[model samples]
Target: MKYKTFQTIILISSIFLSIGGCVTSKPSAENNTNYTISPPVSNNKMVHVNGTKIVDGNGNHIKLKAVLLEGWLMWNGTLWGAGLTSETKITQRLEKMAGKEQTELFRTAIYDHFITEKDIEMIAEIGLNTVRVPFNHTILEDKNPLEDYSARGWKYLDNLMTWCERYNIYVVLDFHSLPGGQGAFVSDPEFINVWHSEEHQQRTVDIWKAIANRYKDRQIVAGYDLINEPDAPTGKNLVDLQKRIISEIRKVDKLHMIILEGGNFSSDFSMYDSPLDGNQVYGFHTYNFFTDETDVKNLEKLSELAKKQNVPLWNGEFGAHKLSWIEDQLELYENPKFPINGWTFWPWKRVSENSNRYRNLAKIIPGDDWKEVAKGISDLFGPSNKITPEFTKKAMDSFIEAVKAENIVYDTEVKDLLKKY
Candidate 1:
């Protein structure tokens, strides 16, 4: 079934407990000094790798409970109510249907309102010290030869980094979608498979090198996520490509930590025979349908792998289940014996009313035919259909309004859960 279709009936009842408490304590200088020296200092300190732990500038072990900033730079049709297969297609279609000027206006509005300074401040208030910003590779370099790099794309990222700095939150830059597409999903929009194309691989490396050079000194940038959910059927191919990217990144900046994900949508790690490089963390994605036993076993295996390689393990993406499931996952992650270094929830926000599993903290009205339009280019899978220009305009207008209003429906329960960690 299509992802949209499956989302409707995937709900399972969950019993949630009201977990609440508050502590009032007087601060003593002696206690403050002892706590301050511990890992994860409250101050805005640069984060780096220290053996198997991610530590702050003060050498305190830091655990990043972060939220993934999705559907912003990297547009997901299911989340954004834009029926396009990829971000490039969305922009091109919008420009064609609404003219360049109008398209630019809509794009600007989306970027400005999607996750603003207020959102970052709220994330900080929730006790999340980091955010994973996912972006399409095209944002950096739209051209093939990598000659004309776009400064406009960098502006959005720069804005986010600035906000992160202000909120004392570390940012993890994720190259979510790559040129020529790394996987078969619509999000990975390209004619050829990236793993098979040497040109695409080189361009990917060049993009990371560029990013490293740009944000190497930014303390708010915690690390570089080489790629998001790479589907490498041939595990060796993905492993080799990641190593090359790491080598390229190291050439420019060695201060920030590098995050390397496993093959097959970040679920398999058998390909990793040894540590790829120093100051690197192994990333894996898990969505085990809230099965506690399975989730625990999966995490245990990954943690064992991390131990074997003497590297830290991070759940780069998770969530899309009941709040109870989220709570259970967090509990497993915080296990003392098989402790997970950190985790970033799958998404910070999205619009949906049927089920809460994959819904974001906020919901918006998608124009009438949103479901039909979201079916994607019909020629490939279903009947061909186009969203009328009038409909597009109305949708964009309403979305822009929602963006500006920024009246998000806060998930206080989830927020409280995160803050406790």
Candidate 2:
């Protein structure tokens, strides 16, 4: 879609909003989700949210600030897994992410997350106001396939909305695993050799229509992510077909937000002369995994697009390939042009509470999942010199030795992790 700026101000004034604050420690839920620390605790970055200017889901205006909960394993597993499911586990994680303010979400895979009303209760207590539900085509229909909402999945979706409404968390129905997997899912047999086939395009539109009709009410459902990320193809026809999908989504869900992605995987955000509609918003996926550009360039692009679109530009996904960069990015070196409502890196931990080995098992929590702890986050995670056996034994000995002295206090948290490895 194509988006441009607007300059119409009848009146303006400064407003004092309560910025959120929280402890740097990983949160625990096995006992309670209460926090004991105070702010100016650092967040992932200097999250500067643009204000006064109005924005909206459809055509209306609203304020935006969000964090992506991408793939939180425990949140889904604890609620809808095959064996054990716990509300306490999921709620604890969400509550921690909510910090002290209302948080939005961009859930990567909401697959099999259909569970009981009790699950919804836990989510509400955590302070979430929105959820993006990604539906695999299989769940919508079983055919080789046209766009059709799966029989069993649609029923569960309705139930999900019912529970969401009760808890007040809005929903974004994302067509996550599209026929031709977007990027990571690109290995799927469906899209490998046929991204531009006429069959693929028709199927997508038909499926969207069915979905829009099923949930026409704009109140509970926030928006549709259109088709995840559109990439380049060896065949020109297929590439054109990919862009057409956005037009199709707009046709049906005109009132809701249409999330248009950039070229060849969501990573590259360059203008190809072919731009998104001005009415819709541009979606980008940024990561430290593979990049040659400087942070300055990245920030400049974000700002330029914001000025051009006059709409929100969201970082659908981003995380540090290594744990070391976490603290570095948190310093907020670059100035972003647009308002980034929220973002979700890839997946959350499968076991949110188990890592409480007295240590955090929830991925977002410190040491919960090594991958997440290391991503775009530092300080909280220890150095690489940590993965040793003797180091652990010595640290344990020192801790035991320190406890013997009643007059002293020893903080050996980092030491324990070295030994655990």
Candidate 3:
């Protein structure tokens, strides 16, 4: 079906339950409710080698450059769109918009109410293969009273496993927010101590044990992202703790990949010494366009370690501000000289935009982030893993051609988008 126009209307739909507290969701779907969507699928291939990391039946790597799943469908509190809420009405919209079941990978939000069995089916329809699940520690513990972090979440998670088997996609479980939030300085009081605390470290291990034992039999879960971005009270201790956590999960579920991010949330590729049972994947995040090229060079260094280890490395999450940068990244990936295992971009959107906040995350939706990076990057998926050297060169050349063809620095859509933001 085609949507000629969309309207936003306010409706009251109560999702309250005694087992898990609920509330009335804010504006979620469009007022124009003339659409058809399939529910989530439950026939995933969920393959694994010896019940652990991804591998071919013959012990080869499974190469797939999956797209990064963003919360374009709903907000859950991070930067950008998260500022719009202040713990009040945080998860309502998400819960309301979830469970389309056509999507493959849903990069979860700080509050992932968007999770529903029907949504898993929608993922299968979209031809997606996995969900790169992001979570805050509180999702496992519920530090806030009004929030939910109950063990009951596992009941639903098992339902997700059932879907993965029916639909076949790997799960990259990322710990986005730690007890003290993963960064250097978190204004949120819950993260007052940082990862250096013995309390926080212990809590992390315990949580993983619960996570691992819960789905040890399901091989679709590729690995556990040790911690999100640990810039806090920075030191070698965070690295050491990661090795220990790997040990913990290894003991519980030895058949899966264990991914660890770089130092600065991007990739600093520090040296750490904790070994897994030879089925681990080293991973990192990249937002270098927001940083200097020098930082990117540092992150690129991880490629060497990944090669030496014969382990695959993926940009767990990354997206650029412009279309040009998307192609540039693909070039880096195609560099047989500096091959990266796979890459996933930031998001995919469902909503048009958030009205109140001019600089909201949904900004990337109708206009900015998702649109600019989408086709540009997807186009770079050349026939063989080889990124045609001429590809990015051609992308740059296209802009130059546009400038000469129109003799204009500002395109119409760019101007309108900038004005809107």
Please provide TM-scores, in order, for all candidate models, with all chains considered together: 0.81, 0.53, 0.59
What is the C-alpha lDDT profile of model 2 across 1-421, one tens digit per residue? Answer: 0000100110010000001101121221122123121111122121111231324333344322222333321122221121121222232232243321211121212333323454445434434455555555555666413223366567667887898788776666666555544333222345331243345456676677788777765466655667565543322332344345545554554454456566544645564233444334556665453332335566567656666646566555443233234223322322233455544333212223332221221232212232231221122232244323343333323322221213122123322221222
Whole-model lDDT per candidate: 0.69, 0.40, 0.45
Candidate with better TM-score, 1 vs 3: 1
Model 1 Cα RMSD, Å? Answer: 12.9
Candidate that scores best on TM-score: 1
lDDT of 3 at 303: 63
Give the per-residue lDDT of model 3 (tens digit) for 20-125. Answer: 1112212211221332212212232333322212454345556434443443222233322323231212332222222112111122321233344444554454
How do the residues 1-421 of candidate 1 rate in per-residue lDDT, one tens digit apiece? 0132333222110000001000221221121111111122234355776667888777789898788887788777546655425566666666555566676677667877888898898788878899999887867875423224377688889998998989899999998887766665633444555665667777888899999999888988888989787766467777777877777777777678788887645877888887777677887887754343337777878888888777888889877667778778888878877746889886777666444655354465555554444443222453233656666567677766655425656667766777777
Q: Which residue ranges in model 1 land beyond 4 Å of their true spot?
A: 1-45, 82-85, 88-104, 142-149, 186-189, 289-294, 357-359, 365-387
Worst 10 residues of 3 by lDDT: 1-10
Colliding residue pairs in candidate 1: 39-60, 39-61
lDDT of candidate 1 at residue 164, scale 0 to 100? 90
